[model samples]
Target: MDVNTTTGLSAASALTGVEVVERKGAGHPDTLADGVAEAISRAYSRYCLKEFGANLHHNTDKTSLLGGAADVRFGHGELTAPIQVLVNGRITAALGDHTIPVADIVTTAARDYLARALPLLDTPRWVDVRPRLTQASSPGAVNAPDTAEREASRQRWFAPRSLDDLAERHRMFSNDSSAGVAYWPLGIGEQLAVGIEAHLTGEAFRTEHPYYGTDIKVMVVRHGVRVQLTACVPQIARETPDLDTYIARRAQARNLIAELAGTIAPEHHVTVCVNTRDVDTRPELYLTATGSSIESGDEGVVGRGNRANGLISMFRPWSAEGVSGKNPVYHVGKLYNLAAAEAARRLHEETGLDCAVALVSQSGRDLTDPWQAIVQTSGPNAILASRARRVIADVMEDLGTLREQLLDGKLATA
Candidate 1:
């Protein structure tokens, strides 16, 4: 296939008019679902590897979060009902005669993930986790003839199935095949939006300002060189003494964001707004007992949050496929997304041009080989184009390593 080096307007150049980008914080319900699903998948993979010598066939991507009700006052709040967390999927629960604690493992992983992601949330007190997982049977397991003669005939024709054969068969017959898309060289606006959100909700910021909740969002609107940031941050009720204190904290956060934004892009004029919905007169605030919107009737479903790169870019091509909770080994939905991102990043670095990559994989094909792989660049420079092709080829060659990184938890899928 020929590499198309025809470039479009770079993300930076495309920001001449008003462009908007959004990012969901780590504690947001949809993000929570993604995190929980990935955590469960990782734990299950580890368990299967330790006991069964291979990762099991499981797709735990259907997790959901049902928001809980809460009553908030000036300085405190109470949860009327615990947040309902349901994990739905299929897994290998038994290997030969040994039974794997699938539910227990998933439940523990979910609770631990919530505790880590939303430190302000009293997970045990406000979160109720339920596992609705089942063992995934092979395609013909239930209908296969039980007679010894039939079994002998089947073996004679099929012979002994290897692990790779089983994995390929599972991939071929699975209904969850998907393509992964990513682009590189994020625009200044995109970077600022994602960066500001990360700074505000990051560990250092959280440690300094304990009242700031994990459920924070950042929206960026850029017109030419001017950038505007709107952030929705939840304040923990216990840490806030009253409405006045909350207002003061919000002001401080806003100022800090402006200061940080200036450092990020000094040439651009940046404006910051924090929690615009807050009205002191009405005493309406974004306060939470657990520091998450999930306690306030905001439902979240998996794959509805940010992509693997952590920013939802409207100016660039994006994919809605959720990479988390899919199989780590050969699941193209997961591998191709991560691969495309890396490929785009490398191509941009090597060629100094804005790059976009789309990788599509057919069911049961080799993970490294995509059915349709396209590398689009922002300009038509032959020398740079050649370099971009080399970078993409190198990235494709490294696709096999992605599975290891994913299974080891070294990559962030959410």
Candidate 2:
């Protein structure tokens, strides 16, 4: 419950020198890993709720994607080897005699997620999904009431050890401890970077530019009023008819992004470059069969991708916690990150001051009560500080609302 606030440089003022921001498109390998992990967790939670009336204890946060080799040519490409997708983690797999199809569910979730995220990737033909999930059941864990009664009718149920045991079981199955971090009121440069990236990946934009792949990367650097954006966008071989067409499309996309950046900050001079590594002299380009680097030996692991805000900012403080796939209820890693971001945004809105919020939570502690909560703002007024404290307190007190938002997919960590 400890809360503190102090005057400091705003996120925008702090960027007196070079400010850099990076965002990974949804189809990047690391993003793909995050997507699959979250998909499995959501799928598993839904299954558990329907079958057991509660979300079973599970953490599928160790998902990974190993890039595969491909022989990519102009307008065509062939996978030399299938991308190896490994979904690893633990989950409750049994309620008495009824065994849960954990592997089947996870694998299907992974495939479906990748298919949607990377539409050009032939998931069934180029992606090999391997489920390494293992059962996670405590010795004194109690089954759901319906499951217990069903087993009892079959003469296979066991009595609870004690009232304390039942309480402990309930607490253990309720949620996991995790933390989340967020910040708001993005600076002009950061906003431009994120906006441009989102615009390129947006469905409407992609529909017009069918060759544009999901594995897009946008990096923005701002020095004073000059903003530079470098985008690495892959083009699907099938959609792009030839090298010349790809070049034309890339130019069109770059110009569109530059125009969008100008709209984001009209005072800033903007420059946009797409696929800097491409060399037309050698006829080399950023081409892919699946529009993702996963088909070309770029490995991805959970937590290595974007943060809750969807962009990595070098000028901002960020936690190393990975929020996806963790239990949405009590996982401090996920909760604190989301809470921190919300706190910052709300504080800024109330006080009209740029703010940064950080929160820490201990294991087994109520998520609403954090070990420490810090709020820093560019404003030195005591009224702003007092308002920031009140905002933080209000956010911490409403943990249940945050939980619902998380479960409803309103908060994204990848």
lDDT of 1 by residue, 340-400 (tens): 8998888777767777888777664555556666777766543354665676668777865
lDDT (tens digit, per residue) of candidate 2 on 338-375: 87888888877777777778886766555566766777
Highest lDDT model number: 1
Q: What TM-score number comes out for model 1?
A: 0.89
- Which pairs of residues collide in candidate 1? 7-377, 7-378, 7-379
* Least accurate 10 contiguous residues by lDDT in model 2: 151-160
Candidate 2 regions exceeding 4 Å error are: 13-18, 136-179, 382-386
